[model samples]
Target chain A: MNMSLKNTLKMAIKSILSNKMRTFLTMLGIIIGVFSVIVMVSMGQGATASVTQSIEGMGSNLLNITLTDRTIRFSNDNLSELSMLEGVHMLSPNINWVAPVKYGLNNEAGTSVVGVNENYMVINGYTMMTGRLINPLDIENRNKVVLLGSEVSESLFGQFNPIGESISLSGIKYTVVGVLEENENTLFGDNNNMVLVPYTTGMRQFRTNSIASITIQGTDAASIDKTQSKIETYLMTLYGTDTYRIFNQEQLLSTLNEITGVLTLLLGGIAGISLLVGGIGIMNIMLVTVSERTREIGVRKAIGARRSNILFQFLIESSVISGIGGIIGIMLGILVNRIISTAFEIPISASMQVILIAFLFSLFIGVFFGMYPANKASKLKPVDALRYE
Target chain B: MILLDKVTKTYIMGEIELTVLKGISIDVREGDFFSIIGPSGSGKSTLMNILGCLDVPTSGEYYLDGQEISTYSENDLAKIRNEKIGFIFQKFNLLPKLDAFENVELPLIYRGIKSKRRKEETEIALDSVGLYDRMHHKPNELSGGQQQRVAIARALVGNPSVLLADEPTGNLDTKSGNEVLDILESLNRKGRTIIVITHDFEVADRSKTEITLRDGIIVNRKVK
Candidate 1:
């Protein structure tokens, strides 16, 4: 019911509607700009979300201790004493190497041979699908008992229980004790392509004297930092500086999120440049329109339209163009996100924050670009304008 | 009511100084059907521009209803034009994009009148111009005469104190020209002040008082 505003808006809409194809063409730039911005940002955030979820799935309380030097060795008694530290829930000293696995005529190349103990299954969150995991007695007796990952079990003993079946780790015979269920949340690599055996058995087979890598699970997420520091201080006393490194899961997660956040910002910035170009397009068209309608502006002025009235008329016109373009861009962005998500099997939802920012920035572009031309139109001498042929 | 005292307008087109209106004086009282006739280069168009509040004279005073507004700001002049002056141009000056109804509604809209009142005023103006039935037609859809009538409706919509017509009937055929003259006469009879600037003596002869201008100066006057 604001009389002048309503009147101005009606006039602007009429002028814009008069040139359907030209207006649409002008809007195309903004549409593509907003579309790209939304899609790129959503992809970055989607990647971040999946990676963060997988890492958190393994539990934030886990710590990985690596002995960089081959000379440094940790015995079974030394690892057990570290597990008794405050806020430490569990610990597994692991020795791992890659070799071919064979059972009968079936051979799976590049099988990950992981040496672990009774605490390994619980700490790494592996659940047995059949049979039992390697027990404490297996380590003392140095028995060649192993647990088969789901994929290894499938290849080495298809459709049949791999329990009690003997498999060879590079020509050494090992009895299969259990087959692990399929797990999809492994951060480093596919846990389903690995073999689990007692550390003592692996040491003898691989001929290594030291256990270099160790995984520890804290009692709770809040205690992970404290327990890691305690273990670091304890390790410093044993091996001193530069000989060992402890990787914290929470730190890794944060570092990954930071990287994705920067990438998203970078993509959004590139898309914003396109939007700025689209704004220039609006200005170009608006300038052309002002000149073309010079006589009309004079007539309006003669009929008593104020300079401000004429100014707002063209400004509203450009804003309307960009506003509508932004809406279409958003709808298209969501649609494209859907198509891509389906094609690549990645879950992508265009972030609402990004959508809202793009919409508002587009409107701002309209007004900013429209100012010069509208001012030119408003300042025209009525007599000269009316005389324009 | 309108009065001009010794008004002059100068144009400096890149050091070629030209004085279009050289100390021209004009007067017209309320409800008067006044005409100023001159050929091209006679400065009548410049005089009309000044009277219409579209431009100001370089030197001298312009008084509308006894208020000296020759030195008014651009914004003030716009207000005077909007509320006290109505314009009808030879080209019809109807915004081609707007239909007859919207054309008539423009002045009231500029005046910031409410929609309901503006609609009522526009309807009345279009009815008086005898274009009520064709109010929905655009400028292109209407005949030359009908387009001129819509221009007249637009001029009359704001109920301005003076109607300034710069060759209102110049684009029309003889019959349509006379039709416009007749409407002007009738409206003048109804006590509305009107001023017509034209190069045609016949058009001047229809007015109650007429003047002839040659070389930016009024040379003669006739009481018709």
Candidate 2:
């Protein structure tokens, strides 16, 4: 509340306001820099939520197994024992391989050939757009029938119904049983693209016995922990090793969260570089201001303004600039998030803590970077300064 | 009262040494109207800078109101300038952003005077200079004569012991310059210790006492 400070602030504001275009152009660097940070961070957060929600949408009990320098073995002759274990609900075994699909003489596409039991649709929560899902009788008769993903079906059959149409999988012909509806998710998840086929038919067509993965559904929401433990114990005892990893719904959800967390940090750090550049721009402008206002500084000093008063004046000016930039950047970021959420169907949530953090960070940048110029201005001798032409 | 005992000041440019005031000394009592007249580069400005406590002599002693201020630090010198002396520059260095009242109230702000009392004192000072009606007008809106008057009001607001005028009329026309000189003479007549620095003999003749400098030395003195 010192008068010198009050006067100094008043004068600084008037000076900046008097030159509108120059002030706007000077603030442009901070605007772009802050805008880049806010937009990048918000978009990254939206993308992460999209990916996590997609993974969550895929049934919670899905578990993946990839063999890495270790052999996978199971002693159960049939799959009935796995179903009988405590807290065990149902098991859907899977086998996967790549195959080229053909619809007509010229239309062709490459897709993943997945071997799944009839319970695959039930455990994975997939709906059929046309025809029916895989059945036990089809597996028993070893029928040459396959289901296509929405994308795959559209690419191969066009507007014509693909329920009775014939398609090729690995040089073998199979009738199209159904096409699964497209699930809402991103490219980061595993269900975006694939072709589903009967287990026995897929084994005969590809000639391989390797089980790629197994998904076990829980009895109810309350029995998740029991089911996960039961599945892990049964698998360990059967295989005589605990090398295979077992995951339940909560673990899968947390894994997705962890990945998204890393992505958010990476994006935030990358955007922070631009904020640093903007801070440097402010510092550079302050140094020039100090040079141009040498005589003014002398006048103030001679008029009895303290050194700290001068420093605060410049610091406030820079902080005000950065503060305004932060405000505009936040608005722009929200606008971008809304547009993207509308363009592509997704959900985005921005937290108030993020805005507060960005504002405080910009203020810190102003003070930290403004130190050099403020000190340089404060150190100028009143005598030499006044004599300066 | 102000006293300067054998004061000497020197300047160094690159490697060469130049002395501006060589063992000059003077003393003046309070409420004295005095003029220091000299041509360009006669060390008058340098001596005025020292007398105003804006600069410390390289050697010898200076006393203001019986306090040895030659050894005072920069901060102490600033306090003395704020509390004891008011300066009027030739350029009428009013902050261009501020109006006449703000410029006049500046020293009171440094004196830590309360706002209400400071406003009262500022009004009185501006009215004394015939600028009370134009207190809100900025320097850009005022002519050279009016600006100098505002500057003089600014110097008088704090009721300092001495009013230091350094070529106060140098930048004004003949009529405006005479107006400023008349104001200075009136302030001096009111028993304020007023010291003016000028090269115009006519302006110097208006003061009660005139001290002339030649080659950095005081050569003649006349009492009007």
Candidate 3:
């Protein structure tokens, strides 16, 4: 008989609604399957995004050089020679130490102190919010002038301008010459929490003649590789050992991307196993539904329902179950992602493509798993089915 | 019109061969009301099933309106059942999930009738069976007689050439049974062919013609 698809869908929905608990129980598996996949992929995407942002925060055409051998120090003449190297656009020698600072009644314990030259602000992508940055005179004369990060200034002098104010650091008095801008896209926490001083003053106070690290920007994006290899060869010859590591922004970003990509796929694969289980659950429930509705099948057949009609009816029913489950799962996945991102303070990126793929997979699972039961229903003999209690 | 020529049905259980109908022949004309009466295991149900196109005989030449349906494929027989035969079961097999209107509309839906025409035909069929007032009531909410009437409406809604009822009043009270028999008689009078299968003589007596079956053969045939 020529049964309309609309009528079959109506019948399927009616039957599904008639058994609410069974339908819900069957849908639970699919819901969980879709939920886990979305959540895992979203979190993975978030991690990848965070890593990319951090790598990009280091400056696009910048390279980092950390000296593992403390004995090898870059002298002022050596720094000038390296600065004039081909493909090197700008260079900043830096040192780091931790010391306590006190301004009036506000005291910061173990505050990070960074020693840098005039090129520090340019290479590190820092902008001035209020005062000028440290000049070359500050480094040349070993002047005891310091620049406070935005956060350090806020903590030391709330609502009051701290420029030109004198603060004691490690029992030595220093004047605050400037306050750096508050960078919102800082990779590792707030860069606004540290103090910046001249490398000469930091070297004398910390009792160190060795430079801690060097940051350099290439003349252009294409020149970064040449500059990086030149510096690596120079440092290797000077130290006579491979005691330093050089990393560029592109290398770090690509490595992070690869790691996150593999992690995302692994997580999605684990969740896919649950989806398979969910498909099996649907098949199990569909088989039971067919068996339970055998008499109804017989009645429909006797009323002139063709085998195709019965097959389509059952197939639509299972698809509706999974389709609804997929929708709910998508919503639940978004909600769970929001909750997790908020709780952990991580940025989650749940793309539209992921949601669409998850939904389509659920539908496919429904059709794939539903085939056997629908075929079984269609192959039933009217007489035997009618006789089935 | 229905014609059966030397129709035989057999069932093989392990090493035993059980023949239910041994070359039984029967002819039912248009606008005729007939009853087939038999005791249990007399092959009357088997014959009803074959006539309703619910089963194919082991060997036979069964014709409905000059079509050789005994040799038709399963799908073809299903189409014939959909277009030419309407069935009423003894237990009032109205889908419990559907109301009376939907139950009656089932056959029309299978026929791919549009909703507007299907609703109109369903209403007319329910009105004819006197269940129009209870058309919105589900099977469980209706009395046994009302459910049977709804089943009859479902059978009549398709406008089939033959109405084959298998003990239509078997599960009803005497008053309800008589009401169903009266409806069948009235439908027959309206130029609709009706066949009732029952072992009860009282039920058989309501029909204009009666055939009694014994051991897979017709023992008696009477026309009143």
Give each model's whole-structure lDDT: 0.90, 0.79, 0.89
On a 0 to 100 scale, what is the lDDT of residue A294 in model 2? 86
Off by over 4 Å in 3: A59-252
Rank order by DockQ, top first? 3, 1, 2
The docking category that best describes candidate 2 is acceptable
Give the per-residue lDDT digits (tens) of candidate 2, residues B117-140. 999999999999999999999999
Report how far residue B132 has shifted in candidate 1, in Å. 2.3
As for lDDT, the candidate ahead, 1 or 2, is 1
Instruction: Find the candidate with the highest DockQ and give its number.
Output: 3
Error of 2 at A246 (Å): 4.0
Residues B17-130 of candidate 3 have per-residue lDDT tens digits of 999999988999999898999999999999999999999999979999998888888788778888899999998888999999999999888888899999899999999999
The TM-score values for the models, in the order shown, are 0.83, 0.73, 0.74
Candidate 1 local Cα displacement, residue A202, angstroms = 7.0
Off by over 4 Å in 1: A1-3, A36-57, A65-119, A134-145, A150-176, A182-187, A190-193, A197-214, A218-246, A257-281, B221-224
Candidate 2 stretches greater than 4 Å from native: A1-6, A59-123, A127-213, A216-242, A247-291, A329-373, B65-67, B109-118, B189-191, B202-210, B218-224
lDDT of 1 at B9: 95
Candidate 2 per-residue lDDT over residues A24-71, each given as its tens digit: 766666666666666667767777777666666766555544333257
